[model samples]
Target: MTTRRRAAPDATRRSEESRRAILAAAFDLVGQVGYARLSIEGIAARAGVGKQTIYRWWPSKGAVLFDAFLMLSEGETGRPALPDTGDLEADLKAVLRSTVAELNDPRYDEPMRALNTEILHDPALAAAYAERLDGPLKEAKKERLRSAQRAGELRADLDLDVAVEMVWGPLLNRWLQRSGPLTPHYADSIVETALNGLRRPTRRRRDQH
Candidate 1:
């Protein structure tokens, strides 16, 4: 009697092939036709797989697009993320710098831009966008904030929810609005203003110069 691996080399290769084809087709069709016209059927046809194969893995085009965008970014917004070296500002600057680099990648920008446009016009798609895109980024930002709080680098009284937004809100506003290209210096400014706040400090009698 002998035991054979259920996932044989051929089976594994086939699975990889299907996955690659699905992703490639999803990206290509979305890039070619735009999200409004993209269809599972078109994707399946382009991928050379049955529609059932796509459905078996992802429930909707939004899911596929979300994953494809993430793949394109190589998890820039979430996975393989922020380093905690006890310097809150340094860690955030590093993260934001990576973000700038990711947004500049050609593979990442178009599909994400398409998804963003769709999210604005459709409620269901908007919800999926939140779940897949915004939600993960929010969590990652929050975790970094918590580390900063723990280190006493950021104000302890800082509201975690608001603090997270404070750290990211301005940068995202610019990115989403296409207001301007973000620089590391811009991210650093956001961090400073968020942590130190907008008010100018009052003079202390002991510190007169």
Candidate 2:
């Protein structure tokens, strides 16, 4: 008698479907309940799958949430496409402005808040969250900066990586901390402050008082 391989093509398809289901379920639940309150059973019920199915794929609630949020925010274009209109500053501003709108949307708020609270309670989880969301965003923003550099639109002396992080860090800091409701105006300020740069590399880093 011949035995069939366990991981056949149909098995692969089913696995992918199940994984997608789990991700969708996790996102939905996180939107409904804080990540702290979210549970494997909850995700399983939402996904219409057995708890064992989730456990078979993900090790922890944090893992499921991280993956779910990543998939929700990311897409086929890679990091949501940074509006490359050959005008780097305008492109960055437009994307950031839209991102501010996204952050301010009620549906998006809780999952983001959940992610933020997790970061505060668990540094490891925070690192993982940053790796998933912030890191890719930072890289994509940097790539847009690099495009600007190639086009000679930005000062050659500017460090593209530092500029990207500066632009990203402040705006994200606001959203994740709930320091204030995110705004397009804030996004514009970030772009302006970063692009115009502080102290103009001269008057002293802090002498602009």
lDDT of 1 by residue, 1-209 (tens): 11234798999799767877888889888877877788999999999999998888887887787667666556364364467888887777778777777666666566777777767878987786677667776777778888877877777787788887787778767887889877777777887787777776665544775
Give TM-scores for every candidate, taking all chains together and pairing residue i with residue i.
0.72, 0.81
lDDT of 2: 0.79
Question: Clashing residue pairs in candidate 1, if any?
Answer: none
Model 2 clash count equals 0
- Segments in model 1 whose C-alpha atoms lie over 4 Å from true places: 1-16, 28-42, 50-60, 70-81, 204-209
Superposition TM-score, candidate 2 onto the true structure: 0.81
Clashing pairs in 2: none
